[model samples]
Target chain A: MSSALPHLLVLGGARSGKSRFAQGRAEVLTGKLVYLATAQAFDDEMRQRIELHRADRSPRWSTVEAPLDLAEAITAYSTPETVVLVDCLTLWASNLMLAERDTATATEGLARSLSTARGPVILVANEVGLGIVPDNALARRFRDVAGRINQEMAAVVEEAVIMYAGLPLTLKSKG
Target chain B: MSSALPHLLVLGGARSGKSRFAQGRAEVLTGKLVYLATAQAFDDEMRQRIELHRADRSPRWSTVEAPLDLAEAITAYSTPETVVLVDCLTLWASNLMLAERDTATATEGLARSLSTARGPVILVANEVGLGIVPDNALARRFRDVAGRINQEMAAVVEEAVIMYAGLPLTLKSKG
Candidate 1:
């Protein structure tokens, strides 16, 4: 139970039930539920996953297809009355890393946007640090970079929830 | 001359006069010029470059260090009385990419910020696509990402400029 609208960061490993847990949390918040989707359907399985997610939502939930410029979408659609749910930051991060691998520019932009979010934000991110070191330079770099981002976001956001075995554990409760 | 303050994007290779050209545009705009810097010195050469830039600024200008969270910094500092000059979006992009390598998240965030600028913005970016493909995966990825970010920015901005040999040429200008 938190007083006032607070930005939330939800962290978990793959299939760790983070997405399921985020939906449960988002349903509790007031105002319209808006999903800021960052994943693009590259293959059939991904496309079906996206569709299933879409089908799971009630008509009240507004879905914004923001593969890029998610902060802007959040700003545009989010109000004090709007609860913004960004599912899975890992995919978003991957999209950016792979898309803009030459220049390290996307993370700062996200930090700037997160700092200025107009309404409550529920962000979903994957924990990528517990695994073994990558064998290659690029993979190794990605892991390191993702780890740093998670650390920074966890530091700034109001609260962070880590999910495992389909259970939610409060990591930090700034709220 | 455009009635609406032209949103300019200045692109150039390293040491190819992109920053200088951007500064010149800022000088022509009405009201105060806001210089948003994104570079942090990691070495002696960088420190020297920073000093040179500092020395080059006019007393009337205001400078702000915004290595991360540029969108938030821009919203906080810029006004209609200001001609917001983002000294180098490439640096900000690079910072974000380096911090997390989450290109989609960062790119989306920046796109949102650029779309809702409070005043005229003169953005500086590097033309990374013109160079040879990087030998390493990270370098190649970075070049690709930088190119996408630049295209995204240029698409929404009112005017676009590319600098060569320290000379500014209007690549996409309205009015």
Candidate 2:
């Protein structure tokens, strides 16, 4: 019955082990594992980060790079015998906002896709609003959007967990 | 009995409403309120931020500034009829590290002080270990030390709560 869990949302602050926890949860499922990465390698540092993340995953898991159009990617990759893991939603939101795309519409579409997904889906997002308010307008705006996105995704998921110091605290569970 | 609640350790990411939650929690106690601020106004922006925080607090609450000697400040200010709220320990840890003080020793002193405080104390701390690993050594070291301090303080406090997006989730409680 552990494998019968549906959609899960993992939320945490930076370096909070949200991704690692989500990966571990996905690994427990009995199906094809798909890692849908949203981070774009825009610089040398980011390239190295992407490489490091890639090295951490098992070779058996299929990797899909979807910096934008995440809803479509989820729809395309998810199957009845698959577990699709979206490593993050914040990066995807950033990509949308930076590209002048409508984030609310995009988020709604993603929610629609997740609602009908045939297999278990795990989503990871950063909890970025817990710190001091950013000094600049752009950063503050980013925090608001990212926070809204997390709330939306958390509302859609059947289970929501907040990761902290390598610990997972379940906020909601519908297994 | 709400007023009888003892020590509390509030943890959250930046701007995660930790300070606000701590202030609200402290207000509920039937005692003289004291706000122990640890931030050093090193620049104009910081000064402005500090001023804003000061304005948000009630006039009934007395403010105390302690950037490095948190244990001493806590010991000096706490009384049976006073509720002392330390805005943060992370900044205090950073100040100690920057000043070349022994953080472990300082943390130990803080634990000892809180163990015998005369009144209820509310301590705020940042959860800095959630996101991606920092790119530099100093940042990495700071994250490690801040996380360790949080763990130590959480162990000492009678209650520990993690603030997320303006909500307080109790991690531990003895009341």
Candidate 3:
């Protein structure tokens, strides 16, 4: 099921406009749009925001919840005639931690899935390791996990970029 | 004491190689290099590490401790024959908060100083806002201050880059 289409990995800090930029990139491509959401609504406000976001992308896209098991979701939802956009791996990494799933193994699986993706797959993630080291062990661990995921995913993707203040800084573009 | 040389802004996360990259950029330019250090050694281990870092840059560079009053330090140290490199603004911001200095006003002063720098000035700062929002109010405030500083510096500098894993991703390069 592997295809030659490029897979993109977009990494950025909070409010860096990574998700919107990624969606715009996905929209410009040919095929049915499939959005793989890895974020979970933890409260009523979050749920409302999520619902509003889904509504915003509703008519032009179909949303698939994959807070966990993202690799499987990518493998199942991607097709030659589809454009799959995964609007974040940071939360997914957290979910893996909470579920006691080994992030290193999961990252390897995700990379493999991306390698065999039948369509153009765009992944968005928060670059959370840039801030000061956290005081808590859990946050520090999460930072390490998230950073490791980004470095690994970035290596696998055909293109990678860091978004800042709504600007794209290309890290790599496989020619 | 303003010169026409373009100042550069280098931003990145921890271990993202921003300082080394900025140093390399500064070393490539013609000048007497001066390093403005903003970090303080609280413990003996940190003292040893700071000493090691200083020794690593010795023979070719002079170091000045500017834990606070960074704008004043830049103004005092910069000259047409010098290339001043501020290893980081993240620590500087923290130092300001610890001392109860007005970060916004200090930032304005820094920007003004950079604009009228007597020679080439290369600023290194952590892109700390890219990660998960900090849980502590103080950490959150620090993140916001650092982010604001970066945004302002990015706009002022003629060259701006985000270093990642020792690689430079150019955000803005003046034409």
Candidate 4:
């Protein structure tokens, strides 16, 4: 982790093509491609979603499931020869809530890991706070957690983008 | 109606400071400020929200309640000496749905009004599709409607921006 590479944070709403855009960026970089997926199949809907995402990726990428311990996954998988793409932080935030883990600690750990990452790391997150407030307490809490995570990761990364209808809007460009 | 000034579309999530930013822009323009408010007080919470928003503006802004017939209101209020600010369109979209109005026709009417408006226009809207799929069908339909309205308004406007925590990211710039 001596030589730190610039990290990128990709954010968008549902079906905004953020994951595809991040994958395209990762494919253009030179390294062993690694995908650290944070989604767990708790139901049939989620299972189907996971399979669809898996099918969307090419054979050049190896997958790792890190539903709760995402920070540790990043720390372990990041290498000078590897390019790790964490295909979302939103689900990871929800997973933390479901598992009753401390999110602040986890968020800090994740940010710290990115600061010393040996290879280029690309993170994807859903921008969930742009809509009307949810009726349920849990959903609102999830939105706050997800949004805070996005902000922290964006501050840690060298590049940040928000996607709309497959269009990338530069939020924080690496100078 | 002729001599149309360039229109602006401001988009953001809840508490993203879109309203304040749009108001600042309108205050800088030279004209009598007109606020086309689309929000209706259906309950105590909504009534309080409306009052708070009303208190946010100065006496320079004359408010017009246009919960449904926004296009007609724009046609009546826009003039060479006026700067019109439509506080929001998401609620207008909902109002259209609740009133059983044809959204496609309404959207077209709005677009046409902007084409030949006689004053500078600033429109605000919520970006509601960035979260997880709502569990209910009506909410899903609303997301689609609101997203479509935003996309259309964005295409028609000379300036388009998305607000995040009071920071504006330019989607399109007036040339």
Off by over 4 Å in 1: A1-175, B1-3
> All models: lDDT?
0.73, 0.84, 0.84, 0.86
Summarize candidate 1's per-residue lDDT along A66-156 as a digit string, tens digits.
7767667767776777788887666776677777742235556666677777778888887766544556687667666667667777887
- On residues A63-174, what C-alpha lDDT tens digit does candidate 2 reach at each position? 9999998989999998988899998898998888899898889989999999878788899988877544344778877876887687777767878888878998877778
Per-residue lDDT over B1-175 for candidate 2, one digit per residue giving the tens place of the 0 to 100 score = 3248789999987656788889998887787998999999998767987998999998989998999999999899989989999988989988999999999999999999898788888999988776566677787788888888999999988899886645567899995
Off by more than 4 A, model 3: A1-5, A130-135, A164-167, B1-10, B15-125, B129-160, B164-167, B171-175
Q: Pick the candidate with the highest DockQ.
A: 3
Q: Candidate 4 on A1-175: residue-level lDDT in tens?
A: 2234478899988655689889988887777899999999988768987998999998999999999888889889999888899978999999999999999999999998887677889999988886668889999999889989998999888889988645579889767
In candidate 3, what are the lDDT values of residues A55-115, reduced to their tens digit? 7674779999999899999999989988899978988999999999988999999999998
Q: Any residue pairs clashing in model 3, and if so which? A: A13-B130, A128-B131
- Give the residue spans of candidate 4 off by over 4 A: A1-10, A15-126, A129-160, A164-167, A171-175, B1-5
For model 2, the local distance difference test gives 0.84
- What DockQ results for candidate 1? 0.01
lDDT of 3 at B123: 94
Interface RMSD of each: 17.6, 4.5, 3.2, 3.5
TM-score between candidate 2 and the true structure:
0.61
- Model 3 lDDT tens row, B98-168: 99999999999999998777888989998777556667888888888888998998999999987764568
- A-chain TM-score per prediction? 0.88, 0.96, 0.94, 0.96
